[model samples]
Target chain A: MDFGDSPEESEFRLRLRGWLQGNNPGLPTSSTDDDYWKGAAAWHRSLFGAGFFGMSWPTAIGGQGLPSVYDVIVDEELAASGAPPRPSLGYLVQGILEHGNEDIQARFLPGIISGRERWCQGFSEPDAGSDLASLRTRADRQGDDYVITGHKVWTSYSDDAEWCLVLARTDQEVAKHRGISAFVVPMHQPGIEQRPLRMINGMTKEFGEVAFNEARVPAVNMIGGPGEGWRLAMTIVSHEREPGELGYVARYTKVVNELTRRVRVNPSGFREDQVRDLGWAIVEVEMLRLHVRRRLSDRLNGISHGPEGSVDKLLMTWTEQSLGHAALSIGGIAHGGGDDTALNTYLYSRAQSVMGGTSQIQRNLVAGRILGLPSS
Target chain B: MDVRLSTEQQALRESVARVVDQLAPHAVGEIGNAERTSKLDAAVASSGWRELRLGDDQGDPLATGVEAGIIAEEFGRGLADVSFLGPTMAAELRRLAGAAQSESAETVAFTSDLSSIAIAADGQLSSFVAIDASGCSRALLLAARSDGNFLAEVDVASDEVGLDLTRPSSTLGSPASLEPSGRSISDDDLMRWTALGLSLTCADLVGIMQGAVQLSTDYASQRRQYGAPIGSFQAMQHMLADAFVMMEGSRSVTLHAAWAVDALHPRDAVGAASVAKAYCARAARDVCETAIQVHGGIGNTWECLAHVYLRRALLSSDIFGGAGNSLDRVLQHYGIGA
Candidate 1:
């Protein structure tokens, strides 16, 4: 069992590290600002331009076709260099690459990879949060297009997206899961209304509620055939849960490092519990880091994960929440220190267990599917 | 990096498992079966697992830390009543100090806190603890002289059985004297040795978690309540699943820590092992408790194996220091402490 990088991996890591030294656009501390989002997008474009993004995707999609370890290296180096996180669109990319036909891939993947065309996921509805299969979004068949009418809550980057991946019920006669279908709809269409939601952290534009009223999407944009959206959604969510593929471990490490720096700067300012909280955060984050490395190692060894992504998601949730609590405690935000950055971070951490998949649902999956526990 | 075990390592794990299955105690009543204990002891001694860290001509270990960790984990899984951790640590001390391998079985003595090796001065070994000393006569110590810290051997005095039924520990006893072995060690050597110790303990904790969860899972599958298997309930299933997740995470970190012992620098190796130790030590306790909880009424009984796993977890968790001490090491490594 070797934990050190392979020779090729080591060389690639070195070259990437050198590139990051020159190209890293240091992230702003807060995400609430419009400039932060603009900077993140710009940084994403720069990373794509420099060939540091999409290291694991096939060359047909403008990727280097390198192994996943290269992506792992990119994540570590970016975090180590204090750069903003790579844009998290791997799930969308994978959904299209796996289910979309040749033309759709040729049309959407390059723009997605190059950050030329931004995208947002239209998955959750107000009533269908964890129970996503019960979504009432309808996509009725037309001549050459499907008219989609649905309400999608928690649509991240909806206001900024050029395209949105929508899951709507194409046939109400079949089972709920089988009746669904996936579509790539333009965000600029006339029938789509995107109203930004004010996040608890006071971020207005990071999340939006998009209402599609008979929005027209060409039938060719349908990913796979009808009744494929459930499978596509499942694939997309599984990818979303993977910290290794999404570079979340690095992002958590960055947060923890920031917390560590704060504590270091004012060592006497924090209480004992706060210090211990920092310690817990550090340990949990480090565990996730090592855990992701091991997962990557398993991938290199040709081990495919199934419900294991649920485990990863759960661990990531723990790490983020703990780090968030620690950040709040150390920053003393609850006591009116009024540090917006730490408060924003702490508020954002609450969503980890809810977004992608709830911790409860994840436990159910692990228990029912992975552990073979009989469900009542 | 490839974290999967090689074919030889897998074979080693299987053989160790076979030995444990054949001779290790299967029930609380069988713990003191002298004939079975002797056979297991002989098997372990012949296996040379204790000498896995003994130095070659070039002073490198006979086997890497991953191989030694595999044996430790398997022993932990079976609750094997024979000594492995102590003797392997003794061999590591000897290897680090450039001493010849011992012909007889030996273990290592730690300070009362089990945070470090017991230090000796002027032939007087103070209050100390000998861990994993089930069949050992002598234990290794670090004798601090004006020149440097040298390797020393001390008698076990008497076996003092501890909470862990599988492994016996002798504590709060002064050995006859500290016998200098005429081999000195450096701070870096000690750090590297501690790295191995932490990695082994973490590996052991992972094993304990795996065993505890499997025991609970099997029990839940069979033990019916409310006219159905208790495992059918979401509460019980979620607990076991959570425990399984902890075990898996512990296993992952422990594997890296074990690999880092030989693959990374001494300081870096200690850092990695500390990370694994902190995670596994914390997770092992919760997992064992979850196991006991899953067994319901039977879990509290002394005859049941759930408590045994907890006992073993308690010992391993505190051997090289618990979660708090490990986090201190991690925080110190990160240069982030008051």
Candidate 2:
């Protein structure tokens, strides 16, 4: 079987890599253990201006739509170039256009594409973390606008957002999944509050809580149908976890490079086992790379993200978490004074198994859907 | 980039799922029946799946009516009892090592090893041990050594004193069947095939585990304990969720490895395959245990049939080498010390 890039894909990579050479943001290579988000937003604007972002959206709405491989290629370049992920708004808004209506597209897609507007997902109330469908938030419809009032904790980027695509209960009488509708609620309205949740990284630029009290949004801001938020959220998350093998390959390369540097320096005085551990991590990452690349090929070929996506997430979660943990163990849980790249990695990866639908949820999907296991 | 299997591959997958869902899963409950393994042989002959090996013309052994891996993966999903590895390895021998000079046999044992092939060296092969020959597959042979891989079927008839029943281990005074490496395949090629077979088997176990998890989850949800569906409890949710994630994560790696064999091939397949198998092996264990845990008391009883899946998972996991071996091989391929 041919796993290497096709000649065409090879040519695509050359062109893509060439473009990224000058346009790359060139952050620290060890950002996994460093706060490389120093100029994350400006990096976003630069990448966006280079026409590197939105490579897959229809050109009419600001995308080349050139084989979707271009998007994978670009993201690969972005990661390899050490460019931090753009704002949550950048990721989610374009995501909306892919699944949202034309009206919603025209209103918000351009602003997001140009880096003019930002967004935060208004999901996750205190009561509904993993069981997000059980969230208690409501958006009552008014004449020209809908008044939204709810308490959302751990909204990743609400404070820095111009608007939020809020998932609120529009049909409270219906069971958890049914009655929910998503709306684009403006953040400038009178009744919106955002509070930063202190983090170990202390990067207050992103991640906070959004408490909406009579926040007003245009009635036309409703996306999809009244009960389609579940579908939209699922779609967004699936896409989030399953795209870009090139990106993972790029990351693997970068990590391996870092690992090699560490081994060469030998300052930490690691033994054979530690070296083996480092090597194991590198191999695991490579293994993960192969797995994700296969998925990327499938997705680019117009294959829907199905049980295969679960495989991607599973490998990714373990690889990532393992890398962090390994880094911690080899590099020391808390290195000299205050550095804990590995520790932070370990801590953060704790969420890997838990977030974006926990490991259990993915397994349930695998067992029930992919394997055709009988569910009670 | 996409991770989805192609139409042909998808169809293969469906057929596999159908076979596993309909035939294999049912047959798994009756573990003692030797007839279960041969059932697919008839189907394979009629449907020309066996001919998929020789193909319509046998000119391009790689070019079967379908993708080569489709058959392997389908067998994996079905939990077939046949020795898939022996034939796959033997077929490689026939295709690469010339047909008439060397006779390639499908999964037969105790036929003829090192002592016999070593003395009868005619640039042809006799028998090769399917399992790790790192032991003593060739300790007694010393007359000549082939430059590359050889296909030989080892007969452990004289040495089957304490081999496990589940695994069919045997010892041999002489080689039952053998092909010397006049032009044998590379270690990488064998690894790719082994990885293909193992990854798909893991995929099959994954299927079984998937079924088990569902059965357990369903049972938990429907069966009540302490005035609530057991599934309603947070502890149960966490346990089931762990199994869910394990299965899914295992699947991603497994498919990745499978695709790697085809896509990356010569360079990356070995490492990828090991990782996939390691992940799948471990995941199968987790899935089996969690299914039992989720199933609770009923799951433990043979009458409940939960053990059917657990047994298969355990059996398949150790067949091509267990998790540790797979992991070590993966590390070795990557030049990482295990």
Candidate 3:
């Protein structure tokens, strides 16, 4: 029941804190800007250069072979020091490490870990979002390459990524989930095109619509055997849902801390309900922090989780929305004051329930898988 | 950091769950069943859970707050018709004040608003309510002074079968005689004790949510509608899933609060407990209400166990103050608001 860090964890945290003191890349003005993401990539490279990035991955790759808690500490210190977020490549790394063959691993993981290559996931199409297994993407086998043709929406970082981990149908006669395969398709091929989408938060480069017109990938680039795409996709989504592994707790904490500072700087300006909202926001963020730590504790104790990742996703959604509302209310609802970060924060939070998996879908997974409820 | 329970703590939880299963009231009518109540009381007495916070040789508690919280949570889950929260809180105060432990059964008295512990003055206790007062002869209070607060005790005036039927509370009918325990309590001691109280209530709220969700989930699986179990409906499933998520979040936060009570500084422990209380207090009500909604018409009736959970949740929510008060505590700690 001890919640204090171990000697090793504490030491790592302290050292990371000291490192961040000098190496901090101050937070960008707007996440929607191209410069923000460009700075983000540079920050990722800097952290990697400092031996602070990817510490949880195996040493066989580019990581330091430390416990996952070190990643959490790096995230916590980065946020606490107002640094740009660590590059969210954990899910991509996990997908490749779990499903990629030794050849694929040896070729891609080092570049990904070292931030030499950027990657985006190509799973959700316009027609296959919640029902991702029904994706229309196709990869036809050729002599030495599989030419892919698909449309991927909400493909984050696609505009800048050099590689896209894509899911495409390899067989037409089998079940929807069984017909699919995963590939590490190069993003800059002649047949590939990326158009950045403007989010409600006015973020364009953050999410893009990528179109694959006979994009060629070598046969060796396939992540897993045919019909293994579903498993790989599931691994990626589940890993993505873990706030602890993804360092999302620190991200939310950063937002809540800013809101608290605003309210403290001018305490009487806010209404009671708005103040209450801020307090609730603080509570939700703390809940996420403790929840992630508890999940980490479970991992430390060798407890493997499956659909329970849905629980983490739902909690993260609630916390993000709560923090967003707190920001909006405290920042004032009326617009046009030369400051739209609060509105942007709220707008971005709306994606929490929509992206990764819709809240409804996540709930259905929790019910059917974790609670053993009957499917209708 | 590790939040997993130790082997002994796990064993303690299992034992408490067994006791609750064996003797806890299973229905509303069984709440006052003398046979079951007395047996439950006897089991609780022998279990020494209420004495968990009693001072050891060095005036530290016999068991940490996490152990006490585990017992509290299990009891809350089964709606065990006995006293644990009140007696344990009294023992905690005694330990903090370095006073000798009471021999007979005792409980703690809270203010009329149920926000803070009651303060006795001039050998008379004012408008106060003693919660978890079942089978208790006296309630403990504090005597305020310039130097520090001291421990005091008063007779339980009368029992009031309040909104929560499982556990009875007592209100002072007259000024109960206050007797000084002769040990002073420091501000740090009180803050730490408050942290423990907040944590136990949060743990109880977690248990109540768990019990409510389990009851609703079971019913949803069995109750048929439109030629299928109601649980098969997406609406009902989502409701139950949301409730389950809230319950797990509460459990995670509460575990940290319970651990922080003994591990951190007094003020920091209270801060952590306040965070847990705010989260658990808000989530418990929602989860309990969702449980009622899941059961449809039966949930509205008194016989259904869903309302019992809601009632218990209401009491635990208000014990250290509800969501609003907890938020204020947190805000105050941060010096963020007037």
Candidate 4:
């Protein structure tokens, strides 16, 4: 397996790096602030204008029709430059592209591509976090619209979203998984309320508890069909589990390099145990990087996502937590005190396992589904 | 970069797996059986697998480290008592040093502290312990020297007690008054050799863990507890799943290391090898222990293969200086003081 980029990829990377050097959209101060969203939207538009937004999407859908690796190169360059994250509507777009009907695709694809609109996922509920298929959200069909009623917790960017892809029970008589359907609902409707959930790090409005109370969405907004929510949700979750089209390996490597620099600058202040821990943290990050490359290789080779994604998920959790712990250990009390970036990062790392999927849930998937081991 | 094996590499792996599977039954029943070990060693040698690292008329020279890793992994899966690695390493070293290749299987051992060695006035090596010196006719001593490095062929005087019974260990009484193989080895050559050695060990550990995970998975499916299969329990499933993760992770890193040995720069190759070895060493131990835990009482018994895997993993880890040393090597590769 060749690790070096191809000549074309190298050229694309060089061009992207040159672009990033000229156009430095500063890093976001807070994810939930209006300024951040405005800046992010402007940046997203700039990326789309430069044909960097959908590098791998089909040409029919306003993308460059390039290989997925090009997208990854763009991601790496953006991350390495410390640019704010691009709009994360890729997963939602994937679901719509794969499972949504033509009309639904026409309705949502352009807005996402042009960065004119933003979306949030409405899959998780207050009652159903990891066990998402058992959600109690109800979307009863009316004349031409379905009334959505449910509470979704940990809905990222809901406060800033113009629309949400909500999953709700459409046929309560069927099995829990088969009873649900996905719908594209307007977030600014009268019956919908978004309450910003204050995180442990005191970041407000980044993640919100969205309550849908008889919110009416046109029946045409339904993606796929009734009883297809589970499949669609799986598709979205798999995309979410990906390291992004650009990959997070470069970002993680940057963190490691920063850690090494910090340790090197204050060699005497750091304990031997901390140094060893940092060393191992570096090793873990490198392994994670390799794992991600392998996963990308599989994708490029036409291999679909499998139980191996759970392995990647597990590694991501471990590496982020380890890096944060190393940072905290080195920074000690100064980092632990409020308002420190290290403290913020360490606290945020706690959500890595709980988000995407809990580590426990990932392990279960790896054991039973991936390994084909016996299951309860 | 592609991580999947080529068609030829896949064929080689399948053939090696077949050979290992044929000998697996003997791996459990007869530990340290001289006849069994000899038969396996002879079969491997005659199969010309030992010459995999050193190309023949049919293959390219020193470009098959990946193939060697594949074979080594299969051997590890079968717990086969074959002296392929050491002999292959010796032959490669001889070729690099411009010396004649040894015909017999040669076991390579190392000592970090040269002062621990007892040399006679005649410059003959007195005594040294060779770890994992099984099924070999000669022992090659690798040690640090003032010039560059020393690699000398020695004789295995007697067998010694080793935790891994599947592979034998020995103590060398004295060398045959042979001079060092050649002059001081270059840093690049030393790095390449170390990378190859560590990659093989990593592949072996990957195989051992894979085998253990398979055994435990089978046992968990059949072994019932409280009117249900033990594997049905969340605790057992998660435990085994963690083992599977370790096994796959080790497999990924080992394959990359194998590729790096043949394709990457010497420094990068050594770094990759160090990462593979350190990760595999810890992962193998965890997988084997989890296997025993999942199997309950039977797993710990001598009749069961779990302990055998654990022993092999422990021996493999120590052979390449274990996780701590490997991590240090990694740090050193990164230009960090370790």
Backbone clash tally (model 2): 47
Task: Encode model 1's per-residue lDDT on B111-208: one tens digit a residue.
Answer: 87788888877665556788999888888888888988989887786757688988888753464655677567988998999999999999889888
What lDDT tens digits, residue by residue, belong to model 4 across residues B1-338?
45667888889889888777765445466766667666766677677887766644542345567888998898788887766666667666765565556766676654422111222334445445554567666876654555655567777766565677676667675654646766556878777777888898899899899889888888898888899998889999889888888887787788889888878887899899998888889889999999899878888788898998899888778765778888888877766654
Docking class of 1: medium
What is the alpha-carbon interface RMSD for each candidate?
Answer: 1.4, 5.0, 0.9, 1.6
Native-to-model Cα distance after best TM-score fit, residue B264 in candidate 4, in Å: 2.2
Q: Which structure among the candidates has the greatest lDDT?
A: 3
Q: Go through the candidates in order and give each one's C-alpha lDDT.
A: 0.86, 0.59, 0.87, 0.76
Prediction 1 TM-score vs. true = 0.96
TM-score list, all predictions: 0.96, 0.78, 0.98, 0.92
Clashes of each: 0, 47, 0, 1
The runs of at least 3 residues in candidate 1 whose Cα sits more than 4 Å from the true structure, single-residue gaps closed, are: A30-34, A301-305, A334-338, B171-177
lDDT of 1 by residue, A1-376 (tens): 7778889889888988899888877767545355578777788889988888998888988888876767777878877877777888887887787788999999999999999999999999999999999999999999999999989999999989999999999999988889999999999989999999987888786889999999999999999999999988988898789888778876777778888887788777778778888898988888888788778767765534378889999888988899889878876565655557777788888989999999888999988888877777
What is candidate 2's lDDT per residue for B100-178, written digit by digit as tens?
Answer: 3223234322213210122335423234333212112322221234565454434334242212122233444454445
Per-residue lDDT for A51-112 in model 4, tens only? 77787777776778776656557756776776655666667777788899988888788887
Q: Chain B TM-score for each model?
A: 0.97, 0.71, 0.97, 0.89
Determine which window of 10 residues in candidate 4 chain A has minimal summed lDDT: A27-36
What is the DockQ for all candidates, taken in turn?
A: 0.70, 0.23, 0.84, 0.58
